[model samples]
Target: MATEKLDVEKSSVELSSSVSDINLYTLHEERAGRLVVDPEEAKIEFGEAIASKLKLSHDGTKVLWPQPTDSPNDPQNWSEGRKTLHLLIITLAAIVPDFDSGIGIASLFQLAAQYNTTTEEINNLTSNWSIFLLGPGGMIAVMLMRRYGRLPVLFWSQIFALGFLIGCTFAPDLNTFAAMRCLTAVFGTAPQVSGLYIVTDLYPFHRQARMVNLWTMGFIVSPFLSPFLFGFLVARENWRWSYGIGSMYGAVVCLLIAFFMEETKYDRGVKDVPEPQSGLRYRIETLVGITGFRMAKYRASWKEAVMSQLNIVWRPHILGILIFEGVLFGFGIGMNVTNAVFLGSPPPLGFDWTPYAIAGGYGTPIVATVMGELIGRYLNDWIMNKSIKRNNGVFEAENRLWACYLAVVLDVAGLVLLGASIQKHLSPAGLIFGWGIAQSGVMICTVAVYAYCNNCFPRYAGEVSALINMARTMGGFAVAYYQVPWAEKNGALQTFGCEAAIVAGLFFLIVPLLQVKGRSLRAKFSL
Candidate 1:
C-alpha cells in the first residue's frame, strides 16, 4: 500500500510536468508545425479529444491551416482570387466611412458659418462625434458579427450608413446635422474593426501580419486623402458634395458586399471531411447571394458573445496593447488636426494660407503614411517569420514589438523637428518633412500594435479588435479635446515637446512590460 501511494505521487508529478504539451485552450496552435489547426476541430475529429495530437496534415511542404476540410465552401480553402476580392471589398468598405471622419475637417469653417456655431463646435464633427463613434460602433458591430456572422452586420451597417450620410448632406440645421452624424457613426464604422477579424479567420500567423498591413492601408490613407480631396472639392462646389460622394461610394460598396463578400466564420463540422458538392446552381447562388443567413456550426449564446467582448478588457496583454495604440493614434490625430490650425493661422510665411493651401500641406503626411505602410508590410512579415524560425518554430507575440521599438525613435525625432520648425518659423518644407516622418512612425506603430493583438488573441479577434478601436478612439478624443487649449497655453513647441516625451515614456514602460511578462500573462489567462 505504501509503494502504491508512492507510484500515484510520481504519476501526478509527471502529469503536471507535461501540462505544456496539452495546449487545450490556446488562441493559436502551439505545436511545432508550419500549418495552423483549429483546436476545436481537433477535439471533435480525433479520438480522445486531444488538440496537440490531431494536426490536420503531416506533409512538411504543404501549409494546410485552420484545418480546412476539402470543402470549397470553407473560407480557409478559398481560392486566392476569391479571397482577394473579399479583401478589396472590405478595404473599400473601411475607406468610405473613414473618409467621413476626416472630410468634415476640410469644411470646418464653412460648417461653422452654415450652422451658426463656433469653430470649436464644428470641430466636434471631426473630433468628438466622428472619432468617438468608431469604438462603440465597433463594439456593437463585433458582437453582432460574432453572433449573426460578418456579412449581415456589414451589409446592414452600410445600408444605414448610406442613408444617414445622405441625410447629413441635406440636413437643414446644426441639430439635424449633428443627429445624422451621430447616427452615421453608429452604423458606418463596421469595416474598420471587422476587417481584422476576417484577416485572422482567413490567414495564419505567418501571413496575418502582411494582411493586417494591407487592411490598415486603406483606413489610414482615406482619412489623410479625405482632407485633401474635400478641401479642393468644397472650394469649388458645396461642402455637402463631399458627403454626397461618400454616400455614393457607400452605395456601391454595399452592392459589392451583398454579391461577393462570403461568410468567413469557420465552422467545425467541415473538419477533415470534405463537404459534398451542392451543384452549380447552388454554388452560384451562394457565390452572388447573401450568405450570412446560414448558421455557423458552433453558435454561442448571445449572452456569451456579449460577455466575451466585455471580458476582453480584463486580459492584461490585450489591455496593454490598447493603451499603447490609443496613445500613439490619439497623438497622431491631434498632430494632423493641429497642423491645419497652425498653418491656417498667421504663420512665419503669412496668414494668407487658404483652405486649399492647408489641404495641400496634408499631401506630405499622406504620401509618407502610404509609403510607410508599404515598407512596413514587408518588414513586418520578414521580422515575424525570422523570429519564428529562430525560436525553433515557436512564434512569440513579442516579435511584433520590434517594429514598435524602431517606430518610437522615428516618432520622437520627428516631433522634436516639428516643434523646433514651428518655433523658428521654418519653411513649409520643414514642417512637411517633420509631419511626414512623424506620420510614418505613427503608421508603423499602428500596424505593429494591431498585429500583436491579433496574433496574441486570434480566436477572440472581434473582441480584441473592438477594444483596440475603442482605446484609440478614446485616445484621439482625449488628445484632440485638449490640444487647442494646451497648445494655446504652452505654445506649439512646448506642447509637441510634451507629446514626444509622453509617447516615449509610455512606449518605454509598456513595451518592456509586455515583452518580458506578456507570454506568462497570456498563459495564465487563456482567451
Candidate 2:
C-alpha cells in the first residue's frame, strides 16, 4: 500500500512539471526586449496548476501583456462596460482639438475679409500657427502627464482649452483670434496625446491595435467632419457661429470627461502601492489633480520627463517611423488645407464651387475614412496575428510595416489622380475620388505606424505618443507653409506628382530597411 501511494505521488509530480515546462510566462521578461512571444507555448490546459499563476485572455488561449494584478482597481481588470464607456469618452475628447482647428477651414475667406487680411495671411497666422503649436503642446502635456498624472492634466487642460476656444469665438482682431487659436491648440492637445496612453492603460498588446483603430478613427475623422458640417453652417449663418457651436461642443466634452473619465495612471511597477479608493474620493482626487500629487513620488522627475521625450527620438526604429509617418501625414494635411483654396478660388485659378457643394464634397473623405477604419480595425490585427503564427507565435514589431505597402500604393495613386484632376480641371467626382483614396491611405498609415512604434517601445508609451504627435504636427506645419505656393507655381499636377513620388520613394526605401534590419537597429540602439 505504501509503495502504491508513493507511485501515485510521483506521477502527480511529473504531470505538474510537464505542464510547467510548457509555461511561457516565465520567459516573458527575457523575450520582452524583442517583443517576441510564443502564444501557442503560452497556452495551458484547463485547470492546470500553472494556469492560476498567470492571467490569460478571456478565451484562455494566451497570456496577457503587462499582466494585471488581482486588484479590481487595475484598469486592465475593469469590467467591459466600464472600459467601453471610458474609451467612448476619450474618443469624443480626442476629436475636439482638430475639429476646432478644422472649423476655420470653410470660413477662411469670411475670416480674412472680416479681419481685413488676405486668406494667405490668415492661414499662416492662425491655421498654420495652431497646427505647429500642436506638436509643442503635446510635448508639454506629456511632460506634465508623466509627473502630474493623466486625468488631471487632461481635465485641467480641457478646461483651459474651453476658455481659449471661447476667446477664439469672440476675438475682435486677427492677432487676438490667432493668439486664441494657438492657445486653444496648446491646451487641446492633451486629449490627442492622452488617447494613446489611456488605450495602452486599458488594453493588452493583442487588443491595442483594434482599440487604437477605433480611437484613431475619431482623431482622423474629426478634421474632415468639422469642415463638412460647418461648411453648411457657415453658408447659412455668420462665420462666428461655427466657433460658437464649437464652444458648445467643447462644453459637452468637458462634462463627459469630468463625470465619466477615471484615473488611468496606475503604476504596474509599484508593488506596494495602496489600493485605490472608491466612489466620491476617487472622483474628487482624480478630478482635482490630488491623485497625481499623491503619486508624484513614484513618477518621473521633471528632468527625466523632458529627457525621456528627447531620448525616444534617438532610437532607430522610432526615428525612422517618425520621419516616414511624418512625411506621409504631411501630404494629407497639405491636401486638406489646399482643397478649399483649389475649389473655392474665383475664375481660372479655381473650381468656383459653392460652400454647400464644398461641404458635400467633404463627404468623400468622410466615407473613405470610415472605410479605412473598418478595414484597418481588422487588417492590423490580422497582419499581426498572421506574422505571429508564421513565426511560431513570436511577433516582430517590423511585421507591422507590411501594412504600409498598401498605404504607399494608395497614397501614390491618389496623389497622382488628385494632381492630374485638379490641373486639368477634371470633373468634381475625379477630385473627390482621389481625395478619398489619399485620405484612406493616411488612415491606414497612421494606425500601422502608431502600432509599430508602441510595440517597439512599450515602456516608453507616453514619450512615444508625444514624439509621434510632434512629428505629425510639425510635418504638417512645414508642408502647409509650402503646399499652396508650390501648387500655384508648379501647377497642381507637378506639385502633387512630386508629392506622390516622395511618398513612394520614402516608403519603399524606409519600410524595407526597417523590415530587414529593424530588429538589429533596435537591438543596437535599445532605448
Candidate 3:
C-alpha cells in the first residue's frame, strides 16, 4: 500500500507537470512559439499592421498573437477606456483586502487592555492568523478563479470578506475576532492573485509592464498605508471604526464588481465550455457560473493547480527570486512594525507619538513607494525594451534580472541607513529618509522580479502568481512573528543589519545561478 501510494504521488506529479505545456500549446499558439515570428508572414498577415498601430511586441517584429476574433466582448479587443476602468476596479479589489493586516497595530495596546491580554498576544492576532493565511488563501483563489471564472469567485469572495470584516468589528472576544479575521484572510487574497492574472489575460507582453505596475501598486501600498488610517482611529480609542470603514469600502467595491467586472477566463476547454441556454437559468450561470468542477481555460485540474504551487519549492530559479523578495519585504515590514512600537514609547529618544502622529509617520513611506514606482515604470520599461530591441525582438526571462540586481545595492544601502537610524533613535527626518530609501529599493526589486515571473511562465501565470504571493505572505508571517521579540533582545542595528546581509547574499547568489540555468529549466518545463 505504501509503494502504491508512492507510485500514485509520482504519477500525479507527472500529470500535473504536463497540463501547463498542453494548455500553452493548444490555447495560445504564439505564446508557445516564444519570439519566433517570421518577417515574411509579418508583411502578409495583419500582424504587422496591428503591431505597428498598437506598438505591440518588440519593434522590428510582428505582434505574436493568435489574432483575437474581433468581438467587442473580447478583452483583447476592448477599447483603452474600458480596459482602464477594469484595471481600476481590479486594483481596488486587490488593495482593500490587505488593509486588515496592519489595522490593529497602533491599537494593540488598547486591544490588549480591553481583553486583559498582552500586547504581544494582540499582535499575534494580526500576524499568526491573517498574515499566515494570506499565501494559502492566494493559492485557493487562483485555483477557484481558474476553475470557476474570475468574476464569480472575486464577487463572492469580496462579499464574504466584507461580512467577516463587520464580524471582526463587533467581536467581543479575541478568539472570535481572530476567527473572523482568518475567514476574511481566506477570501481577501482573491483580488491580488486574480488581478495579476487578469492583466495577463487582457494585455499582451509588450504592454504588460505598465499594467502590472498599476495592478501590483495596491498590493504593495496597502500594508504600508493601513496603519496610517487605523492609527488615528485607534488613538481616539475608536478602534472599531477601522474595521467599520473597511466594511463600508468593501461593500462599494463588491457592488461595482458585481455590476461591472467581466469574466477573464478565455480559452475554455471543449468539455467545460458553456452550452447555449436561455432565460433565468442562463442568467444565473452567466453571473455565478457552474463550471468550477471542470478543467478551466488554462487546462489545469484542481489537483494540478495545487501541485503547481507545491512544486515551487523545488524550482531553484524561482526559489532564488522568492528568497530575495521574501527577505527584503519581510525586513521592511519588520522595520515598519518596530518603528511604530518604538516611536510610541516614552524615553529621551522616543516621540511618545499620538495616533495621528503615528499615522503621519507611517505615511512617510508612501512617498518613497510612489517614487520607486515612477522610477521602475520608466527605467525598468526602458531596460526591458532596449534589451528586446537589441536581441532583435527576442526576449529572455533573465533580461529583467538586471533591474533586480541593480536594485539590490539601493535596497542594502537603505537597510544600513534604517538600522543606523533605529540604533541612534534619530530624528523624524532621518527615519523618513532611511525608511523611504528602503521602501523604494524593495519596491523596485519586487516589480523587477514579478515582471520576470509573468513573462517566464505566461502559460502557468496563475500558479506562478500564487507561488510569489505565498512566498511574500509566508515571509511576512515569519518576520512579523519574530522581529519585535528579536529586536527587543538584540536591538535594531543588529536585527536589520543581519537582515540586510541575508537579503543581499540571497540576491547575489541566485541571480548568477538563474542566469546560468534558468533558460534550460524553463525549456525543460515547456512543451
Tens digits of per-residue lDDT for model 3 on 1-527? Answer: 99999999998777566543343223343343144333444344323433333223346454544344434555767677878888999988888767776676656667778789876787677545687788888888887776677777888888888899899899999899889888898888888888777887787666677788887777788776778777877777678888888788889999888777777666633334443344665446655765443425545676776677666556665767887787777777666656776677654334577768878888877788888888888877788668767766556777777887667887788877776676677777777787888888878888887878777666667777788788777777777677666667777667778888988888878887887788886666543
TM-score of model 1 vs. true structure: 0.86
423-513: candidate 2 lDDT, tens digit per residue: 8899888898899999899999899988888887776777888888888888888887887788788788898899899888888878999
Best by TM-score: 2
Residue 90, model 1, lDDT: 90
Each model's total of backbone clashes: 0, 0, 0
lDDT of 3: 0.72
Candidates' RMSD to native? 5.6, 4.2, 9.1
For candidate 3, the TM-score is: 0.86
Please give the distance, in angstroms, between residue 81's alpha carbon in candidate 3 and its true position after superposition.
Answer: 1.4
Candidate 2 residue-wise lDDT at 217 = 85
lDDT of each: 0.74, 0.84, 0.72
Worst 10 residues of 1 by lDDT: 27-36
Q: Compute the lDDT of residue 513 as modeled in candidate 1.
A: 90
**TM-score per candidate, chains pooled:** 0.86, 0.93, 0.86
